[model samples]
Target: MNIKKHAVITTVIFALNAPVWAGEASFIAELASTTLPQQAPVVASISTSNTYFMTSAPFSANSSAAITHQPQPDPAITLPQLIEKDWWGALAEITVVLVIGELLYKTGEESMKEDFDYEIEGNTGRYFVDRIVTTESWKLDDNEVGMNWGHAYAGALYHQAFRNYNFNYYESMLGNFLTSGIWEVFAEYKEVVSINDQIVTTFGGSVLGESFFQLSEMLDTKEGWVPATFAGVFNPSKTLRGWFSDDTANRFDRQQSTDQFDIYTGALYSTKDTADISTTTMLLGVKASIDSVQGQYDALSATPSLVELDMELGISAEGIEDWQLSSSLFLGGYTQEVKPTTGSRESWGHNWFIGPSMGIEYSSLGQEDEEDFFAAINVIGLSAGGEWQNADFNISVRGDIFGDFSMVKPFASKDYQASGGQFWGTKSVLWEGGYAYGLGHTAKLTLKQATENCY
Candidate 1:
């Protein structure tokens, strides 16, 4: 009986102390509010309907006061958010990606380096055992043009020559794949050079240090070869490129349940000696991408002879590994050609690319030790959209249905646009391939020994 009575008393006391616990929590919250100014209350006034400084004012409020309130907060953001926001964060991500890509390219390079590693055999042009992995193998007739178009001749010992290398590391840098590492580096030196009237080109060059640093993230990842979102900078060198480029983006975003919106603008300016006058271009854009693939429009206009509006419908799945597909119907009216207009000249055209694409990636292969790789294919007319590879070789093919996309001014504008307008609708094709031996594999004999023994 005594034990039961004691238990009941303890239970009653515990229940009575529950209010004390609540009181302690209230005290701590009040203390925190008082200590942190940023955490102070935001008192909204009835008459002004504006939120004002609440710290210096008295803590008294009338029962009939119509003021509302909320707590203020500290200004700092989390690290992950900061990383997604700052350019430095982007640099770090790119660096890590580059290092990995470099390693993968080297892995492939080593497997095939020996095929061409040995010296020439008997001074014959043919390499009996070109350890150089053949990325591409094929035959071309007169219809096809070699990457470099030039003439080659030879003299006894002394000769003078000149040649162009179409596809090399330097040229590759101008493309979308910035983190291509050695491929980029190799391309840099892939030029046809002439000596003694004979022209020769080899893929033995290295990438520039600056180029490597800029495209770091694209280095090691499977999708690293995709073009970066950033566009190329326009300069005097590209005055003849036919495309007007400016460093800017039209940005628009908004919060829900409000008509208010935010708009941001950007620009770039430069001057060159050959260029007679300095020009300032203003890019103005306003837009919002809707969740549904119905319709979206972005337009920009400023200065004389500059006006553009693009309307597009974009569709994207929201989830891990979800792919995005978009089609834009473009209508452009160029008040003046990218080049300054002289005499009454007007050019206007509308072009559209209806490209649909899908991609998938597997993180784990059945074999535990095997590395993960992704494969995707896209078709732009005759151009095979994605890249293809096996253990021994890799191939990438690209071609425009018509040569309309060609950067060079092939023919006269009147003649070309009239005749070449078909070229845009016509098709051009590009194919590239690479073959390499498996890792740690090597040929035991030199080219001379291998050739002699075969006979």
Candidate 2:
């Protein structure tokens, strides 16, 4: 390995220096031939033919001192020949580099192996490591039929993976001609038994697109605006493995943990990965928040304040048959009435909502070795998402037209609320459009791989 590394380094150095060395040598040679002759020559022999001509010049001194004094061609110092004489310098430099690189590589490799081996052999004290591990998988979909906005999206899996305990954080994004969307961001945790592959506990949350969009619009300006979203989920996959009763199936359902509403704290425990399909999972957690809203109009202004708390019990099947589907029904309440300002048309009230969602994704097996294709769709409450993937590139489209959608907000003085009831009369307009100017509107890029593994 050390030798290979040295060779690679040497090759890189040579590649970088070849053109420079050649150009320098040529320049030096030209300067030597043209400039050196004008100056004193360090070394040159005058043949008898040139010497005789110099001595017979007209009006030349006839004294013995002048006749015997020989002017050797100014010592010839040609730069072109100097490079050849110094070629050994470059060789010596490369040799020294190779030697040092070999030593470092050997030392690093030994250190890495020794450390890993020592840890695995239980030399360290018995202590749990709460490290977040990540794995990557991708899918592609091409030539999808019937979809108006066909695009591709990539998904990432990050979580705390260990025996009897684990957690997850997921995100996705895709765009096409019609629209673009993101999965926002969410995290989930689980605990289960190792023997039966049973999930005993879980907790998670996700940010909703509508909420994200709305918040983004409130803080936008002339340029543009983003969205706002925050959501969470809870489930336990291992607790219902033993029974076929209705209680087991309902164990994973989303239900309020207590009468409290809108709380974001809770105690959670879970088991390890025991089976391929993580079906039996349970979650019990609290969700809560506080908010202040103010309104400004031409002649009226007022601010409103509110606070809320909620607790929920939920169960779900995280992974099933190359697919995952989950549902939850939660109930909660908010501050009944808090009037921060008198003359504002706002009220604080308690409301409960149950949201159910399902997602499905498909990709050809072993297709990654060569090329791959993939597609997926998901929906929860008033939001929806879909994607397509192919070998060369991926495109995706996501749009949510339900609930309170967020709008673009530029600077504080200039904002467009999605909830703004604006109308353009006498004509209809498309929400999105596209056109290609050259070669069907294509873009090409080149990627260079790192020579050293940094990760």
Task: Please list the C-alpha lDDT of all candidates, in the order they appear.
Answer: 0.20, 0.21
Candidate 1, run of 10 with poorest lDDT: 153-162
Q: Which prediction has the highest lDDT against the true structure?
A: 2
Give lDDT tens digits, candidate 1, residues 45-119: 111112111111111212222222322321111111111123343344435434654575457665534323234
Models 1 onward score TM values of: 0.19, 0.15
lDDT of 2 at 195: 7
- Once fitted onto the true fold, the runs of candidate 2 whose alpha carbons sit more than 4 angstroms away are 1-210, 213-281, 284-455
lDDT tens digits, residue span 158-182, model 2: 0111100111011101111001111
Clashes of each: 30, 70
Once fitted onto the true fold, the runs of candidate 1 whose alpha carbons sit more than 4 angstroms away are 1-85, 111-183, 186-455
